[model samples]
Target: MGAVLAKSSSFLFILAAGYLLKRFGVFGKKDYAVLSKVVLNLTLPAAVITNFAAMEWSAQLLLIPVLAFLLNWLMMGVGLLASRRQAAPTRALFVLNCPGYNIGAFALPFVQSFLGPQAVVGACLFDVGNAIMCTGGSYAFTSAWLRAGGQRLSVRDAARRLFSSVPFDTYLAMLVLVVAGVAIPQGAVDFISPIAAANPFVAMLMVGMMFEVDLKPGYLRQMGLVLALRLGSAVLLAVAMYQLLPFSLPIRQVLAVMVFAPASVIAPAFTVKCGGDAGLAGCLNSLTILAGILGMLCTILVLGVA
Candidate 1:
């Protein structure tokens, strides 16, 4: 427990450090955009390559990513339904902010520390499906829904955006490698090792740089509703995965805990792009991280994960 808290505190401290640095004029307001590019286009993809190379093929574990993909679509649909009467921007705001999971920089570390190695693999597989939606899937869908990009939600547009994302492309390529039973070269893994190791620090720092908490009228209501709906679905998903799925204990535990992961790290950026409130999105994102931590703790206890 002490170890877990210690690691989590370090991550939070880095996040806080970024915020403080920005306020103190050490980092310009737009500096996060630079770090964002580095994290998204470089470090994140490096991490993906490393993790994919490290895995041995397991056909049964493919179910994990499918669960994650379906979960994102489900939440997005729920968000749309929740704000059916609102304008396109409002509906887009709800849709953008509601789904996706921050499993890589947040949940994966905890899983690695507590849940044993197989669970780590489960978490990695889970992130495959998650990266799809987080990187571009949700954004493309929302953009098409709003006609924001002058492209309808055609298969071509979606595929084009998905391919353009470095992280998503990396994930796809790695998926192919895994399915083909092809191994990534050891030298390549070694080259990526140092870069991949920097992903969490860089990703968290970017989040910190972008973090804002300007409360406005209706902020609480919107944030509260989003968090309530997200966590509520998390509980239901956890129960279903734990009880209904035909899996071993470790995989089941991973599924239960993964469901409680926070909002995607990039959700705020997407929300802003979709005409949503940046400050409120950041607030909601941060709140979900807290809620995710608590919910995951309860899940661990209830499931008696070893």
Candidate 2:
């Protein structure tokens, strides 16, 4: 418990530093886009390539992505049902914010520290599905639903977006290498190592740069409802995986930590693109990061090094 709390505090301190930087104009709002691009295009994909390139292959490993995809769809359904009575924009934002865990930035470090290399591979695999959802899947779904009355959602456009995403492309390349028993060259891995190491810091900094808390009555109510459902689903899913899944302890641990991960960092971007409320989405994203950190701390304490 002490160790977990210490790590949690260290993580939060980094977050607070970023927040302070942003607050003091060390990082302007527009500067966030620059940091975000670096994270998405460089560090994040580098992290994925480095992790997945070294993963040991197994049929059981395939279950991670499938579980990730299913969990995302389940939350989307819950969000849809919960916001059914809301306006189109709010409903779309609610649903968009529901799925897609922040696996790469927020969850990976903890998994790597506690569970070791093989478990990190499982978490990376799960993040493959999440990358797809965060990159294009949620946007496509929301756009289709929002335009159900008129024009059709452009499947081709969505596919193009997904393929063009740096993280998704890296995931595909790594998976193919894994399938063919091809190893990334030692030189290439070494080259990416330093950049990959920057991923967690860049991710947290971006979150802090974009952080905002809106206490307006209507927004507060809506955010509370959505967060409640999101965290509740995470708890239920984590409990089920821990108790009933036949996987090894490490795999179960990865699954549980992932469930408690916050909403994707890309969610607010998608919300803006879908004509939803970017401010609200950003608020939710920031709050959930804090919530997820606290939640994972409790989880580690409860589960211990199982």
* Candidate no. 2 TM-score: 0.89
- Model 1 misplaced regions, further than 4 Å: 84-88, 104-121, 131-152, 248-250, 265-279, 293-306
Model 1: per-residue Cα lDDT over 1-306, one tens digit each? 555556667777888999899999999989998987887777777877777776656788888889889889999999999988787766777798788988766676556546665676677778878877887789889987765432334567556765786766676687788889888899999998888778778877877787666667778888888889988989999999989988777889998999898898778877777777778888888888778878876787677663
**On a 0 to 100 scale, what is the lDDT of residue 262 in model 2?**
86
lDDT score for residue 291 of model 2: 82
lDDT of 2 by residue, 101-150 (tens): 98866787666555666677778888877776776777778778765222
Which lDDT values do the candidates have, in the order given?
A: 0.78, 0.78
Over the full model, what C-alpha lDDT does candidate 2 score relative to the true structure?
0.78
- Model 1: how far residue 214 lies from native, Å: 1.0
Instruction: Give the runs in model 2 whose Cα sits over 4 Å from its true position.
Output: 146-152, 272-275
